[model samples]
Each structure stands twice: as structure tokens, then as C-alpha cells.
Target: MDGKVIFIGGGPGDPELLTLKAYNVIKKADVIIYAGSLVNRDVLNCAKNDSIIKNSASMNLDEILDLMEKSVKNGKLVARVHTGDPAIYGAIGEQIEGLKEKKISFEIIPGVSSFFAAAAALETELTLPEVSQTVIITRPEGRTPKPSAEAISKLAKHQATMCIFLGVQMIEDVVNDLLTHYKPETPAAVVQKASWPDEKIVKGTLNNISNKVHEAGITKTAMIVVGDVLDTEGITPSKLYDKEFTHEYRKGQLN
Candidate 1:
């Protein structure tokens, strides 16, 4: 029917992790543009045999928008694929703005983020009632200018569960910033290539995480998680499931 551009989240590096909707969009699209290195080859293989596939990494924003505009105008379906969830660090904002200027129709399909995948790889709950109920997702500022309020050091003061992205390459700096508020013995973990066959996990306190990660040679594609939740030393059950806890679904039970 009419032409449209659908942005799909490839979900980490596992092809099977692709949402059913994402897989279906890839199967029916006439053109596919995926982020190179970020997306797994197996996920790209879901595209129809005749689908025109292009690596977005090799092209600039103008080139990418040009392709979508041309394809949509020609009444062809274009699937713009990104690694993990398109919302988190997917870099799709500029492309979306471009599509708007050209008046192109587009839809976004959500995918599993690497941070959640990292959580799954560790088999740990991100939120614990008494330990830390807040999970702060952040990154260390690099070439990208981070706002003062979102600075790593400032965010560290909360001492809540923290998942750091794109900072493994400069983990020492990250740890240094974190140490501004977090204790040296605070639990920390690094999960590299989560959900991939070559995934690696490193668990340690803040005092040793940087060295452990460096020794493990994890320079990229890793998720750094910190907080008391990872320790699991004396985690207690949540109020949600407590026998004496009352809610809309169930009445409180008394001893």
C-alpha cells in the first residue's frame, strides 16, 4: 500500500531476541538500513531476499535520509534497524528530524535494551526495596557533552542501582567519578557482549572493578552495573509478595 519507514530495535546481539513485530517488519520491507557492527548478522538475515540492505554506519545522516525519502516516495517499505532499543543511544533523533522535514511517515518498534540484557546475563534484580529502589541508567561523558546535572559524579551521589553504558573504554575515569559518592567497597559488575555467545561477566566491588575489567580486556560492547543489588548477601523479599502485604489483587494475611 502506501510507503512508510519503520525503525526496528534488533535487541542486543541475539537474533532470537528480536521482537516478533520487528521480525515481521524486516520480512516484509523492501529496503533495510541497519547499523553496522552494532547489529548482529543473524538479525539482518531475517530480511527478505530481495530487500535492499545498506549499512548506515558507512553513510552519514544526509545519505541515510536520502535513501529513506527516495524509497518511501516510491511506495516501498523501508526498515531502519538499530542495535538494542532504538530509544537508548540509538542516534536516531537526527534521522527522525530529517524525515519530519521531508514529511515522511515513520513508526518505531521497541526492542530490548543492552542494559536489560546485561541484567539478564547477571540474573539479578535491578530494584530491591531496602537496598535500592531506583535504577539509574547513565553514561560517562566523552566527545558528547553531558549536561552538568547528568554528570557521572553528580549522579553517583544517589547511591542507587546504576547501569553505565559506553564508559567501559574509560572505566577508570568512570570509577573515579563514581567514587565521589559511592564507597570503595560498593558492589560493581561489568557484563560484556551480553546475550552474545562470547559474553563475559566481571563481578567485584568498586575498589577492584576497573582493574578487573581492564585485565579482562573488555574495551567495548559492555554494560557496567553498580549498587548493592548485585551483592545478594542479605536481600529480603519485597513487600509486593509478602504474605502480610495487602494490595488490590490480594488481601493481607495475618499470623
Candidate 2:
């Protein structure tokens, strides 16, 4: 029988956020490979006692491929666990292509991304009428390859609420780039490890975001959320809250 590889999104360092299906699949996995730096150890505890667990934090692409190939060769179901959705910058495409060369079957299991968690943690809606109907998620290009057009300043031109990931280190550059489009007083917030215990939120505008982040001593594992959506007092109520906004889902007032 051909063995299979399961790509599991471990969620934002919180075990409770894991889907029941993911938990079940993990419990039955014969070989589990996880991103040691980000994934919580509590997630690994779900594996069976006899299961083989390995951390991919220090491993190179060849090493990771070798491990998976060896495990599958032994007829063990391998689980490749990632911090969030494996599709976004997870670097799984290369691995999948390698697996294809070896004829290995694989399944991808999506999980709750940090952006959604950040929004929920802040109790702030990403989309609000006239403020911003769209949310853009991107990062400042550094070691990672990004199209020139996708530069932070370019994306900032949209002036839409943005969830910036893996770019805290470049906050100064981020601030400068965003200032080209966003006002210095545009509201922004930095959420460190959303939904996780000890998560921190630092609120400020574009002009002071870096300073606030510096004072908070936050360097990584955080996301930067920017836009007027953070302006709770200045914005009008949602149409759903309007007295005359009738809808089939909920009853509206006649007066």
C-alpha cells in the first residue's frame, strides 16, 4: 500500500484552535514533522506514544525531503505540520513537487490564519463601509523573493486595511513606505501572537507605530494591522445597525 503525507496547519500557536479533524488525523499519524520554532509542543502531545515526531526547524530542504521519503518508504503516514495555512509562503510547493517525482500522495489541511485571529482578538472588523471594503495581506520583501510591484509602498497605495506578516524587523522601512500613501496619523495596531496567552497589542498611528513597537520590546511573531478600521469612534455604525436597513435575514424597523 502507498503511504500518504498530510500537511496540517497548526494554527497560531494555540492548540484549542485546531480543528477536530486535524486533531484526529494527528493522533493517528505514524510520523509527524512540525515547524519547531512556531508550532506549540502541546500539539505534538496528541500523537500516539509510538509515533515518531521530528522538528523541521533546523533541517534543510534536502533533509526534510529525505525524512519524508524515508518515512513513506517504511509505509508510515507522515504529517507535515505548519504554523498556519501551508498555501501562503509555507514553502510547501517545492516539497510537493519533490513528492510528486517520487509518486507520494499528499493531503493539505487548512487552518485558521493569524490575520483572522488578530481581527478576532482586537474585536475589530477588517471590513467597514466607506472605511475599507477590502483587506490586503502582504509583507516587506527581504530575503524572500517578491515582485517589485508588490513592494510595501506600492501595496500601501491601496490605503486599505493591511495585515502585515513576517516584516516586523523592517518596521522602519514599513513605516516609511506606508507613509507614502497612508497619513502619518492613520490608525494602526501591532498584535503579538494573537489568541495566544500573553498576546500583546500596541496601538498607534503610522507616525508612532515603530516607536510604540520599540517601547513594547516586540520583535517577532507579531502582525501589523493598519487602516481607519481601527478608528472605532469616528466611523458610523454598520448598515445592519441602521433602523431602516431591511434585510431578509433579520427584521427591520418600520418608522
C-alpha RMSD of each candidate structure in angstroms:
1.0, 1.7
lDDT, candidate 1, 92-192, per-residue tens = 89999999999999999999999999999999999987899999999999999889999999999999999999999999999999999999999999999
Q: lDDT value for candidate 1?
A: 0.93
Candidate 2 stretches with Cα past 4 Å from truth are: 240-243, 246-253
The C-alpha TM-scores of every prediction are: 0.98, 0.94
lDDT of 2 by residue, 1-255 (tens): 367899998888778898787888899999999999878888777899999899999999899888898888888999899987777768899999998898888999998788888888888999988889999999888888899999989999999999999988778888998999999999989999887888999999998999999999999989999999988777777888788788878778888
For model 2, what is the error of residue 22's alpha carbon versus the real structure, in angstroms, after optimal superposition?
1.0
Q: Candidates' lDDT values, in order?
A: 0.93, 0.88
Cα deviation of 154 in candidate 1 (Å)?
0.5
Task: Report clashes for each candidate as comma-separated counts.
Answer: 0, 0
- What would the TM-score be for candidate 2 when compared with the true structure? 0.94
Clashing pairs in 1: none
- Candidate with the greatest TM-score versus the true structure: 1
Model 1, residue 54: displacement in angstroms? 0.8
